[model samples]
Target: MIVVGAGIAGVACAGELVRAGVPVEVRERGRVPGGRLASRRFDGRPTDTGAAYLTADDPDFTEVVEGWRAAGLVREWTDTFLAYGADGHREVSGPRRWAAPRGLRSLVEELARDLPVTVDRPVTSVRPGPVVDGRSCAAVALCVPGPQAAPLLDPALTAATRAVGEQRWSPSLATVLRFPSRRWADFRGAFVNDHPVLALVCDDGDRRGDDAPVLVAHTTPEFAAGHLAQPGAAGPPVEQAVRDLLGLPEPAELVHVHRWTYAKPTAGGVGTYHLDDEGIGLAGDAFGKPRVQSAWRSGRDLGRALAERLLTVGG
Candidate 1:
């Protein structure tokens, strides 16, 4: 099995296939796996710029999450999640909101390390041509975001692959702030409801690591949309919004803005899609209603579907 893109969905699919005794090779465009579930460093502290926490709604994901928790790859951060309510910021206590003791994204990176992953090798295109010059790939999985995966497919079957258009994703900017000391004493996390530019503010040191103080503020889709058209995925609006939201007195020692051109799901897709004709399949957050659990379940389903198809073919 050849899985394109090493995000959680891709990793989950490959991991399951490997467990089924199927040899899998993961091709990732980035230097490391994890995709949107990515982490970065600041003054030696690792902060997740992508997904903050995951809430498992599906039983399959819950079971997988349990294993992850046992292996120390994941942990229950909290039962309550802070969101904007009629009051201002209301703490809705229900589902188990999980985070990494280190960084949420690190879990993916750790699990994918030993696997056969080809980094920095972006798949330019895929056709019906031979897998090994004539064999036709036993199967190919395209796990990249929709906009990115569309053009890389063969023109003749582009419509079938046009399943890409069935989905839509948004962009966002993450501005990391390292304060001299702790600022907000309310809770570990906060959802800024009324902010024009900022959407979320999370204290990195609260659950992940012990440090002086660090805040990772995510920009609203409206704000990120305007800035995403720029060349690189970084800029000033994101930084300024972080300071404005927290009312920062001055600049911190280290400041970095990471703009995700493809962030949230604008329009949710089906549970998941599989293209058997060309031996290609697709999965991601956009594969369903935007959520970490949705993405995980999508990968799970994709893996099962692929394995079933492979079994029908032969051994």
Candidate 2:
């Protein structure tokens, strides 16, 4: 079996297949995996720009993340999260959120261990044996977004997937703030439900339990849309929006902006899809909803289904 996309869904799927005694190759378009839960280096420091944080309430998700935590790749974060609403700011308790020691992307990286993953290989198309470039495979699993998946499939499958549409992914603008000294914020993270400019302000440095000297602020969807049309628009307005959200008299030392065109899945079909004739399957967070836990479940269920099918085929 072959898997496209080395993100959470792809890695999880490939891991399942490999453990099931199936040979799998994971292909990724980017240099590294983790898709939206991405990380980058800034001023000699690394910070998480995608998938700021995630909480798991589902038992299945807990088991999967627990495996990751036991591997020393993930850890538990405090439950206290402050909410800055119209009334005022107050801390609240909720399910414990888990974070990777290095970054959320690290979890994906760890899961991909021992798996043969080829980076920088963009899957232009998928077909029966002997496609473009003379590549051949027995089975394929597509972990890309539904819209992107439509074009790569056979004509018959294309029509069925086209009904799913381009799948409008919610846009997001992340602004990272660098501070010389630690600025005290009640708790590690704050949620802004009814704010105009900022949506969430997070002390990722403290959240990671590292003295990384960094803070991150996210803009509301409306705010992100207003300026996302332009490529470089995330600079000034992002700074202004972060300042407004912080409700601070002064700005920080420096600010950085990251724009995600396909941030999260807004819509997907009824459930996951598998084409027996095509000898492949499809799964992603976009398969249902845009959450890490949802993605994990999607991959697990898809992997199980594919394993069952593969067994029947082999037998």
lDDT string, candidate 2, 1-315, tens digits: 788888888888888888888888888989998887888777766688888877787798788788888888778877888888788888888878877768888888888878999999888877654242257776788887766667776665553355346465677778888766665544688888877667777887876778665777777777788777773566666666655656554666777788876678887755754445556577788776678887877777778778777878888
Model 2 worst lDDT window (10 residues) = 157-166
lDDT of each: 0.74, 0.75
Q: Tell me how candidate 1 scores on lDDT.
A: 0.74
Per-residue lDDT for 1-315 in model 1, tens only? 788888888887787777777777888889888888888876676888888788896877888788888888777776755776446667767667787876777877765766788889787777764142133568877777888887777766654466777778888888777767775554667677877777887777775746447777788888788777662344455556656655667666556778788888787465575555666788888877677777766776787788877778766
lDDT of 1 at 72: 84
Residue 222 shift from truth in candidate 1, angstroms? 1.6
**Candidate 1 weakest lDDT stretch, 10 residues:** 128-137
What lDDT is reached at residue 118 by model 1? Answer: 88
Candidate 2 structure lDDT: 0.75
- Give the residue spans of candidate 1 off by over 4 A: 81-90, 129-136, 209-211, 229-240, 247-250
Error of 1 at 9 (Å): 0.4
